[model samples]
Target: MSILATTRTVARHRRLSRLELAAYIAQLEGQNTALIAGNTALAAQLDQAANDISGLSEDLRVARGENLRLDAALTATNARLANATSVGSLPQHVSTQPVPIVQRFESGPVLRAGASPLAAVTAPGKRGDVDKTQPLPVVTTT
Candidate 1:
């Protein structure tokens, strides 16, 4: 009878301890559920950031390719202009005009078609042809 009373007391104490442990486990399970929810939200944000990064990388690649094309076109145009605008260094095989074009400046008189400005052929406001047989006065400015 004494042993049976001691066994019942211990069994009741064990049952109470099991109930306390179960409550503690339930609290930990609730915390785990909240932490899992937070982890899911963080994963979604990371995925969105990765997607934006990929889009920017593709745009940079396209811009670089366009810049390279424009650089190549500029180099070609410079070469073509350098070839066309040569003053005296043209190729020997490529035939060009040999006659030199002389540009005269206006200083004293306006003469045209082989008429010399040193010899006065016609006066101003007179409609007359150039006279080659004339000896004009020589004015010297030392």
Candidate 2:
């Protein structure tokens, strides 16, 4: 072949190769653009999630502190409460004091309201089988 024609063909072939390389580079650039947009969206979502987690962690910390405070207050107040309450000390005062024993008894017959039934029961118009009406006695265990 003539040298001039050979050089022209070689130049044309190189131009075609350059065109193909440019098209491939353009396709990779388009893919990279799409990937950059996807990465940006993902970063935004991750940031929002991290913010939410921080808020929840703060709320949990506050709740734990409040619970500890309440527990300490309750412990202090319980320690301050009295073991027992009492009125003026007297022998009759002992008799008048409220019965602390819980009675689990079911209904025994109640009196008809106007008298003593036994040698001990006391009401309005009653003397028992004993010599005189006396106050119902209460026995206390020391």
Candidate 3:
């Protein structure tokens, strides 16, 4: 071939190669952009999953605390039941003394003008007009 024709052919081949390289670079850029977006979405999902796990861990901790409280209550109830059963197994004996049934009437504390509000409670049925038909009131001292 003539020198000018050969130079033209080489120039055309180089231009074609440059266009192919540019197209390949553009395709790689597009793929990189898609990969970056996918990575960002996956990272968000991972963060959400981590938050969910943290919440579940807190719930599990609360449940464990509640279970421990229930277990303590169960232990106390079982102890009481054991004590009651043991008491039931003991011999029963009636008391020799007759139990008296006492009756009582309660009155609000009387306020004398100068007296402190924390005054002591008085004996019941101390009022003079009490009828003999009613049983005498019992006085309780603390």
Candidate 4:
């Protein structure tokens, strides 16, 4: 072909190639913008998750400390109860002799029928017999 016609054809081809390259570059830029937005959103979510984890960790620490305090208080209470029980035991010496059942009136003490004033009071046995004698312990509160 002629030289001018060949040069014009090469120029037209180069212009078309540059237009296609510019359109591709625009598409790549749009895709890059979308990727940057998505990365920012992901970073925000990661920051929120980290804050939540930190709050939960603090709550767990407080709960563990409260649990330890409650455990110690319970242990101390149990020890106090054990000591009180050991120290507040009943007296060992109790009167084995039964006391007389005397009903005192405004005037003086009276004895019922079938009961003597000098006779010792006896409690009934488990088998319905009145022969069992239970020891009575005198209690005095100061």
Best candidate per TM-score, number?
A: 3
**Predicted candidate 2 versus true structure: per-residue lDDT over 1-142, tens digit per residue:** 9999999999887775767989999999999999999999999999999999999999999999999999999987776553233334345535564555443112233344444444443433665443433344444544
Residue 81's C-alpha lDDT in candidate 1? 92
lDDT of 4 by residue, 7-119 (tens): 99998877747679899999999999999999999999999999999999999999999999999999999998887788456466754444443312323444454454434
* RMSD to the hidden true structure, all candidates: 11.5, 10.9, 15.4, 13.4
Please give the range of 10 consecutive residues that has the lowest summed lDDT in model 3. 101-110
lDDT by residue for model 1 over 17-128, one digit each (tens)? 7678899999999999999999999999999999999999999999999999999999999988987997777788765644332322322444464565455565545777
lDDT for predicted candidate 3 compared with the true structure: 0.71
Q: Which residue pairs show backbone clashes in model 1?
A: none
lDDT of the candidates, in the order given: 0.74, 0.69, 0.71, 0.72
For candidate 3, lDDT tens digit of each residue in 1-142? 9999999999887774767989999999999999999999999999999999999999999999999999999999999899889845555563344434331235234345433333333334576643323233445432
Ranking by TM-score: 3, 4, 1, 2
* Cα TM-score per model: 0.40, 0.40, 0.46, 0.42
TM-score winner, 1 or 3: 3
Worst 10 residues of 2 by lDDT: 102-111
